[model samples]
Target: MVVIAKELLQYEKDYIKYYINFPKIYYKQENDKDYIKNEMIESINELVFEDIMNFMGVVEDSYNISSEEFIHINSITEFQVGYASDNIMSLAIEFSQLAGFYDISYLKGYNYDFKLKKEIILKDLFRESVDYIKILKKYIWVQAKTLLAELQKNEDESLYHIVEDNICLDEENTFYFTSEYLVLPFSSCEIDQEILNLLEFKIPFNKIYHYLSKYAIKNIVKKIVL
Candidate 1:
């Protein structure tokens, strides 16, 4: 269980915005039409995997931290693949099970050691979990960059140049751009606070929160407008 400080969560958001958004903004101003489309597509593709993995990883890490038992590392590896395949429901189930294990383990640990308060252990777990999530996010971003570079090489000339240009933005700017762009839909649905809370170590179940929030909003809007 990792407890992420609110300030650190904000820092992550700021880092992403500064690193990711600057280039897209600059390129949008350049009137590079083909490049813009390709850049957007590439961004969307990268986010499709990154966002899911982040959410799932955070939940699992939180669970592990609270429990103090090394969740078989295989569980994390399985989630990475499950999420990449877009099996979000299945991912949520797996994550929740992991969280349950953490909660139960923490309780047992407290009973075994009368000196440690439950709250203290819980808080420590949360902090460690957040640290783990942050590390995983960085690793996934690196993988996305490599994949994007290879894809750009095979793409049309105009598109390749556009992506290349955007990629040239400093890391902070690029992160900023990508987080803002990809998170828009989630934010518009009014799940921004929920997402922020998950990042802040205030929430225990990110996967459930995210899936339910998004699904509920989509359904409500569909009923109202359609």
Candidate 2:
């Protein structure tokens, strides 16, 4: 049971001035499906507004939560979707924050190694399970130049450094997958792009299918085809 103190949200002298409310973000749920789903909600509830405020030192309140100030929480389920799955292939938790025109993303995940009958702590699944670095290095220059040209055309040359920093792919790079595309999200401010939001690159699965784990390929084909 969640215990709420009488003065939980009261603005007292000793109490925290900045507090974040936990809103229901789960799109679906039920009595039996509250295992992982419940845990995800609990993790988000722990995020404090002061931590973000002190980290970014921007706003004391979340009223101006536009592109300037926002928090995005993302979770990835690698096996059967949601808490319905009896098997836990992998679970990834991601937090993206944008404050005062600066943004950052933090990801933590654990993958169940079916063969080993154990679990592997993965900093990122995309970089570990696939040859993403090789592919990115092969095509980065063209992509970089294309983005540069677009920025120059828009007369936003000041963000060139930020754009350059993101052109590379690594294990620390944040990503999640969909039916057809692998969405790599690089969260940043205007210095990284023109918006204080995530600049996502959606790459087709066919391009990197050969590099995915056999289990992933098998299950994903089923999801996309059937």
Candidate 3:
């Protein structure tokens, strides 16, 4: 898919304002361009709307966000790009004016499947790995629990639940990869205050290699040495 449009999707109010730094992707595959475009647009719409719902809220309620200490909901927006030669795209919400609370931002990944000529989401990357999901959850919680203690808080247990639910080991979490690891983005509320970007939780590709699909492993293998 090629990005045919990049524009702002905006909403404004006296106290609350929201927008998405939207990138409209169009399919380029010759045979199924129309079908692919239809599917991709629908996928992007659903995903982006879900993002709005998850984030759009008043600072005084819902998330219990600190309105007194921080500014009101100025804008809920994201910047995204096709990553790794357009194999997948990564988007991260611009989290600001949240009383310096690290829990306010998130990262997401999207992909266009070459074989299927359709857009694939984060969940499709691991949908078949039920057993692997169980093991990965254990590892993530184990690591998160360690961080919680370092932060000197008893909230780690609750934080674990938050991340776990988002990570249905299916499709809820945002993730991408680098030359070495599959990166799982987390809000500081779930991990720790020290992590400020998409580099929230990096797991070595080797650790989860067995659980990934053949197609996924092909993309990952390029980044990580076996």
lDDT of 3 by residue, 60-134 (tens): 353355445434555555654434344344444444324334335655555555445566555555537456557
Which structure is stronger by TM-score: 2 or 3? 3
TM-score of each: 0.19, 0.46, 0.58
What C-alpha lDDT do the candidate models reach, one value each?
0.24, 0.41, 0.54
lDDT of 2 by residue, 84-203 (tens): 122333333334443333544443332333333443332333435566676754454455566656766766346555445556567655455544665554545523545454455556
Could you give candidate 1's per-residue lDDT for residues 85-164 as a string of tens digits?
11111011111212222211000011001122121121222232244334324434454356446646765752322122
| Residue 27's lDDT in candidate 1 | 18
Stretches > 4 Å off in candidate 2: 1-130, 137-144, 156-166, 189-197, 221-226
The deviation in Å at residue 7 for candidate 3 is 3.0
Model 1 — which ten-residue stretch has the worst lDDT? 105-114
Report the number of the highest-TM-score candidate.
3
